[model samples]
Target: MHMLKKIGFYIVAKFVPLLVIMLTTYFFSRWLTPSQYGQYSLVISIASGLSIIAFQWINVTLGRLIPKSSADVKIKIINSGLILYFISSILVLFLCFIFGEFIEDNFKTSSYLIALLAVALGGFELSQRIFNSEERVLAFGIFQGIRGVVFFSFALCFYYTEYIYPGVVYALIASYILLSTPNIYKLLFLRKKDFIPNSIKEIAVFGFPLILTYVLLYVLNSSSKILLTVMLDETYTGYFSLGSDTVQMIIISVMGVVQLAIYPIVIGAYNKNDEDRYNIFSKSNQWVLLILLPVTAGFIGISKGLFYFLLPEEAYLRVIPIVPFLIIANLFVQLKSLIFDYAFHISKKNGKQFLPVFCGAFTSVALNVMLIDGYGLEGSAFSYCIGCFVYMTMSYLIGRKIFKYPSIDVGFLFKVTVSSLLMLLIVIQIPNDSIFQFVISIVVGALSYIALITTMFYPQLKKYINSNN
Candidate 1:
């Protein structure tokens, strides 16, 4: 497939479902009370956090190893991964069972049930990663889209029936079960192989460090919710979660598409010691910033208007102050993932990757604890922005020292930043008193950004367009 077409499919595939899920939550928040929505968010955060600890390393390992492996070795690696997943799943379940009461008290639910669902969801996610590593972009996109559609459809039904939170849980479990089926078949029936102990050990050694890294990163991202739930109440958590989740959906969708599409190419180029690797890495960052910068700015500029359209007035008002901070925080998070983190991966200095995230996570936790008591939800948002800034700064410094990819074009970056800022100024000046104005403002901002980008890089853009054509 042509690289551009592949990237387009990947982006559309990921973006559509993410958009659906975000919209679903937006509607769900309206139907459910703040406390109820907060509980739902808490459930998801806990499940996602646990899943990261249990399954992230496996996911990372597959992405790192599968592209370089022979067909037979790929099968072996998959088998090894399956074995590890089963073992880890069982262990996690046992631990959940052992601490069921503590878990129940903390999340105010059945810990065992949430644990079981998380394991199932983690399995589905791991399968998706496998497909991604194999470069089965269509399959990856299709199954992910299916999960989003099924879950949203079910959740909608539950919302109308007045069983919002429990219904969401059931919908997710069912959707993930359906989504996991194909990957299960691929692993167990068509390409089944005996477990390879040596392969398992190799994957373990390569992946364990990533587990800690991801856990700290998750803490950095999620500690605000946890602190809010602790310091104030679930209602406060709900407000913060709503803002953070909204921004996160946008960030993850864009970053996921870019990372999934480019990671293998980057790795392959580096492995072969191709000089083109530098150009590929540099251009990827440039393109990423070009898209992400304006999107982030636009989100910040229109957040008040957009949230009012999507959420109840009270709920929307509660989050207005923090939305820009969350958007900025998420932007930093995306930058770290795409550029700094990948540098460590390419250099095989995975261990060094953990330190910066650790520092950030520590800062996040400390600041949330201290600030939430005084500043409320806004404090949490500010802490998150600070933590992420620290993480990005540290990662860039460490990554440059360990292994440097090509530097991004400062002149191009300046142009993109200036253009995006101009769009933000234009967007913020638009009256957000109604939905029509809100929509028009977004359209105008986007078109203006595109116009500026074209003017700034017309020759390169024209050449690329002609080549693709």
Candidate 2:
């Protein structure tokens, strides 16, 4: 019952933020035109790209050390991570200053906004890493929930201002500052005695490789949008980002909550000498597959109506056609981030993880360069999917060998695949003319899936219950 309550809290935490994000997206999709939204998306993407470069290494270092570190050492690691972030942020700001003119012209955004976005983004993310490592689910939930509400409130205020898209960036900066205040306040009490100068060097040496790995991952996700904007225009970029981001939201709403609920246990167990950690990791991966695979299929099944409801008619037409590719690509990305990449972390072979991401980014960029000129949007979308596939599968294949993780669960795979196919067939056959019909079809499909899966698991469920008795 305690576990159940903890899981419930994590869900509320992730769901409130996710719901707010979806609502904001829905409103913004129509309130702002494709061009405006595309530019706004581009601004956020660029800021994210720069921020990861600054924070990824520190993120990797903390993820590895925090789960097992003593209290004093944990303070050292956090303070060191902050120091690294500060130095990196300063470096990033300098680069932005030098490239301010080019950025302003190319991205339709200012260097000032980008820098603020990077600082806020890095701070917020660093705080979450601490929360995740410490297994502070309630704190994680509270902070994330607060950030979402603050963001939405300020976002509405700025949307009507003359600043428009840039106003949205300001709103984000404000929310991040507000949410990270408690984290920042706590840091002030860390003693200078705890700060290790060599710890900085160790973290730097270990985390440097991950910087590129993260940049490659970012490339796998955002390179397409960047290239599309350059080769085509903002409208096409907007269409692609909308489909991709929507699929991402759904994946998070389903799989992310499960991960949050279980991730602390998995990390915590790994810090001690125990065989149970692998089992926990395997079970979590199984949950990811069981939930996401079917959700991916069903998302594609109802994507037409979903987009129609969310986007303006003109944008809907362009977005729906590419959503399948977007869905496939996003599934792989999430799977890699949440599950497979942990193998590299366990082995402390961060460099080995780099190759797959590098290759994936290379493939994505090469394909985009080749395809965008000839086939345009569809071409770029296809490239994104293929690149993600290469990255995800390669990471699993390579990581398992470096450190043996669980083998593929064939029986579970078959069960979910069958259920997903059945759900897909039932959903597509249903007429999806209005949002009302869309809701009904989704409900029917979900109920049908639940019924079938429950039956399939009945034997195991009974056996488990009998064993418990």
Candidate 3:
């Protein structure tokens, strides 16, 4: 029942908002030109990417610190993070003014736009980090939903009013305000005793690697835009950004469900020194692969049709060839994030596990620099995908060395990979004649995956299921 409530709550809280954003995006894209939409995406991405420095390790610290921290210390940590963020925001604002016009001239992201994004981003981290620590994940989820609605509502007004740029900017700024609303209550009501800040240094030390990891992740993930801006134009950047946002909405909405549940549970077990419960996480590695593999395969299989069907015709025509590779890269990227969170937040690997992430980030930058000149956004996509693979592999190796967990069943992974490939082949054969066919193909592919897992891989999962039962 608890599980059901959690799943239900999160589904509504997370996916509902995501759907709102997706729907809004669909309509917004229709109303706005591709270049206009892409410009919005670029600004947001750049703002988000740049704000990484301001956040430092606060998000990571909250997850680990909250479980172990007393209330007083938590408050201090929150306050300090907030204080630090504001300071960073001011510095970013100054930098933006200095280079904002240059970027606007080159990248189509204006100075005013950069400054607004910087402010929104700074406030966003504080609110988001706080909710994350309290495990009021429902609130966190609702925050995202509200932000989307508010922003979309604002955007709608602006788009219709013919103030395209300002409307969009207002929407972003408004979302940040709305998202930060709940945090005010948190700030006012939560007591000094209910939070902890004494462990600031340790928290920072512990979160250092994750800070580096996530920053690189931002760079790695957003490189497509950066490359697009350089290789193509703001117009092309807009297109890639739209598709990328849609993909992210899908991937994050799905992945967020698992992560929200996994974190509190893992932390609870760790706090209690429950090895058995801690070991439950090992099973997650398998479960995530089982779930993600076929989804990735399906996306890759139906790349052309899916792109055409979901996005605008312009995007559909331009983005088809690149979507599959991008989705594939995104899948691995999602998994790597999961692992990083589990290692840093749940398993309490201190800061050491971040070594791979650093290496992966460095590799990603090098790859992007080398590849983007030759291949453009496609090159960036390939680099990111490869980067995710490298990061996941390294995280696994480092995690094992630190935690000494047993290896996952390689045989099972191989079998699932094979099953996914087979299912993909079958899915590809189905002629996409209509919506019905698409729906049927999806159902068939899903069932095929289930059948393969249950029939061929049942023994492996059965043990885990029975154990839990």
Q: lDDT tens string, model 1, 196-224?
A: 67888988999998888888988998899
User: Each candidate's TM vs. the true structure?
Assistant: 0.91, 0.91, 0.83
Tens-digit lDDT track of model 2 for 1-469: 4445656777776776777777777887876778887887888898898888888778878877777788878878878887777788788878777777665465434677888888888888888887877778677767777887888788788777777676777888888877667657766675677578888898899888787788888888899999999999998888887887777877776676667766766677666553677777777777777777788888888888788878888888888878889888888888887788788877778889888898888899999999998988889999999999999889988988887687668998899889988899999998888978999989988898888788878898799889989
Cα deviation at 402, candidate 3, in Å, is 2.8
lDDT of 3 at 295: 75
In order of listing, the candidates' clash counts read 0, 0, 14
lDDT of each: 0.83, 0.81, 0.70
Top model number, lDDT? 1
Error of 3 at 282 (Å): 1.7
Residue 320 Cα positional deviation in candidate 1, in Å, after optimal superposition: 1.6
Report RMSD (Å) for each prediction in the order shown: 2.8, 2.7, 3.8
Tens digits of lDDT, candidate 3, 78-136: 76555445556678778778775566465444666767776777677678667766777
Off by over 4 Å in 3: 1-9, 70-109, 185-205, 208-213, 271-278, 344-355, 431-436, 457-469
Predicted structure 2: lDDT:
0.81
